[model samples]
Target: MNTLDLHAEEFRQQGFTVFRSVLPPDQVKLMRNLAEGRYRACVADPPDRDTLRGGVSLMRAFEFGTAFRDVLALEPVIQVVEALLGDDCHVISQNVLRTPTGRGIVNWHIDDALFFPFFADLNIDPKHVPVYSLNVMIALSDVPTDAFGPTQVAPGSHLSGRRPERSPDLPAGWEPVSLRAQTGDCYLVNSQTWHRGAQNETGRTRYVLTTAYGRRFISQRFYPFINYTMPPHVLSGAGSRIERLLGAHDKGPYG
Candidate 1:
């Protein structure tokens, strides 16, 4: 099977998959530098508006640098995202997640909202997975070991048709899998999957460029919901794909 098919299969059954070496070393370094700069700035002068996910996220990060927008339409990753969410998919959320040492999202939870609570009592077909939102995690910093605190996810937990439990235990033999990634590695997760950031045990900090995509109907969340438009400078030389990912859409319900 082709690589896209493989990713589709993995995603359908496991709720998440990692694509190693999806980015180059130089690209990774550039993104990491951008995140570091933003984090430092946030620390220096807090923004007037509240930050998402507490203060760890550099909100709407893609708007800050070229590399961020460039990575959004990456051919390989886009192909997989489109194949799963359909060709009309658009970016719903994009931000840089930076976790400092001795800090991380230790709780397991789903993204956006629940998808299957009403169907929780029924049997879910393994062959068919209903995916709404997808999170593309680009590793800007090396997460070479558990100490570095890779993203932890429970395989197939998304098919549970319910929210993650208040306790740590999962159904059957399911256990959290640490995605020990390296700089430039990219991993995709179904937004409904049970996931959390393993605590950063090492002194090194963690940086991840997160881009969330959704079906055409899913609302775009570029923050400030109203009166937010893509900066003309950012789209000065961008191609059609980039434009679409940045919220360009042909006539829809509104029209």
Candidate 2:
């Protein structure tokens, strides 16, 4: 069977699916280098809004002007997301996530529920969202169980419709599962699934880029703000789909 069908079936049953080595090694290396460089630059001088109260969102990241976008636009990932969401899918937010060693763990939460609060506010059922939200996590390093804390997910938690209560143990063999992935592997998860970034016990920090996708009708975060002074490619197509998804009509030059 095609990978997209495989992923959809897995997600339907398990609430999560891992695509091993979806990204080629060369592309993964380039993206990882680009992400690190962007991270360093953001650290040295951050935009006013990016200023953090504590640990820099632990997930603060950049999207525009990187080879990473090529990966985001990959046909395999797109097909999988489209299968899960629908035909008219748009890119949501693509951001970097970092877990520093010795730091505390991030809270367990669902992506769609946290970002799109209006679903609950408007009293709209999540089942009717057109395109179901899906989070595509591309691993940037080897995350093992003992050393690097990747992510802990409660399998089948999306169906629960609420955050699963955390505990040291569960009734059956069903406990929070830690996702340990290699550099080029990718994990596709239901946006409503319960999960969190586990603590990084390794001597260094862990990095991953999270690209979110949703049906075209739903709004999106992280609209691209391409710099005008940059090259034509950067400024022309800035925020095309993002603007539409966010329900705005501010078209860019390319748009």
Candidate 3:
């Protein structure tokens, strides 16, 4: 099988898969620059120190600039997403998540809790694959060690159809795996998978750009109606596929 086929199969069985160095180094550098610049600008203002200390999450990033939108249209990345979600898949949310030094741990949880019921109702088996939605996590900075708080995931836990218990004793067969990636790597994760952001003890900030996508029928996680509007230049320059992915073609209630 080809690399795409292998990734699809791995995603079905493991609930997540990583594509190493999927984004160009230059593109990754650009994203890192944008995120760092925005964070610095935000920190300069009078916002409390608490805001500056933790993860800096910027939502509706695609609307912030063309570079953010450009990442959404990256051909190779989109191809893997399309392989799993089909050609009609559309982005539900886009954001840049930056974990600053000494940021506390992000507790383990599923991306969308609503999906648990759907999985249970359907009696989806561990081996039975479903593609409701996914989050494309693009690493904009090197995450070389635990101190950087790389993403920790419990493989195959998405099949549990619920969040893993907080107790020390986990469900049988569940084991947490910390994902390590160089700048520009991307990980495609099933929205229902049990995962968390580890504590950042590193002195430097870790940057990640996340874009969530789902089949066109799935309701968006954020306000699609107001967030979809982009600058006239951006809108005019976007292809039809990019427009649909950006929620322009969404007719769902939230859209």
Candidate 4:
């Protein structure tokens, strides 16, 4: 079988998969430059402590640069997302996450809690519900060691049907796996997977771009329809794929 088939199978079994060098050098350079500039700016004029996540994250990156919008529409990344979430998927959030040396750990948890308000009344088991969301993470810098604060995931934990407990007190039989990859690599992660960002102990910084995608039926996590609008330039030049990913074509009947 081919790489796509392998990745699909891996995702089905492990809740995540990695594709190495999916982003070309030029694209990597562009994202890296944008992230570096933004990181410096955030350091100079920091946001509120709660919004900053202890000085480790930057949200809504697609609003900051056209390059990030392009990253969201990359064919390889979309192919995997579509394989897992179907063609009706659209991006829900885009963020650039940076872990500086000595930054503390991000506790292990699942990403589905935010959606609880929408799905709580269904009264269905999570494992039975089709996975409607996934995170596509692009590595902007090498994360080949634990010191760089690589993300740690518990394999096959999504099958548990509930969020895994904290790292040091995981349920019986589960184990954390440190995800190590080089620049330009991308990981497709199921939002249900139990994962956390390790502390950055090395002097080097760890940079990652994360784009979260979900079925069109799911409400966006970051941007609300009542007040948010896409930039005019983005609306004009974006292709159909970008348009769908941006939720331009998923309007309700009343709107």
TM-scores of the models, in the order given: 0.93, 0.75, 0.84, 0.85
Tens-place lDDT digits, model 4, residues 1-255: 787878877886788998889888788788878877776777777552222444667776776678888788787767878877888789988888887887745678888663343443445443354677988988888988887888888887666656766653467777789889889998888888888888888998788888999987777755445676666776567788887888876556656
* Candidate 2, residue 217: how far the Cα is off, in Å: 2.0
RMSD of each: 1.9, 5.9, 3.7, 4.1
lDDT of 2 by residue, 142-174 (tens): 786646877777886666545544533343644
Off by over 4 Å in 1: 47-53, 166-173
Task: Give the candidate number with the greatest TM-score.
Answer: 1
Descending-TM-score candidate ranking = 1, 4, 3, 2
**lDDT for each residue of candidate 3 in 1-255, tens digit (9 for 90 to 100):** 898878888888888999998778998888788777767766776552222334467666676568888778686778878888878788888878888887734677777654655565566655456688999998898999888989888887787657766543356867888888899889988988888888789888888888999987876654345464455766668788888887677455655
The reply for model 3, stretches above 4 Å from the true place, is 44-55, 116-127, 166-173, 221-228, 250-255
Lowest summed-lDDT stretch of 10 residues in model 1?
45-54
Residue pairs clashing, model 4:
none
Error of 2 at 221 (Å): 0.5
Point out the worst 10-residue segment of candidate 2 by lDDT: 223-232
Better candidate by TM-score, 2 or 4: 4
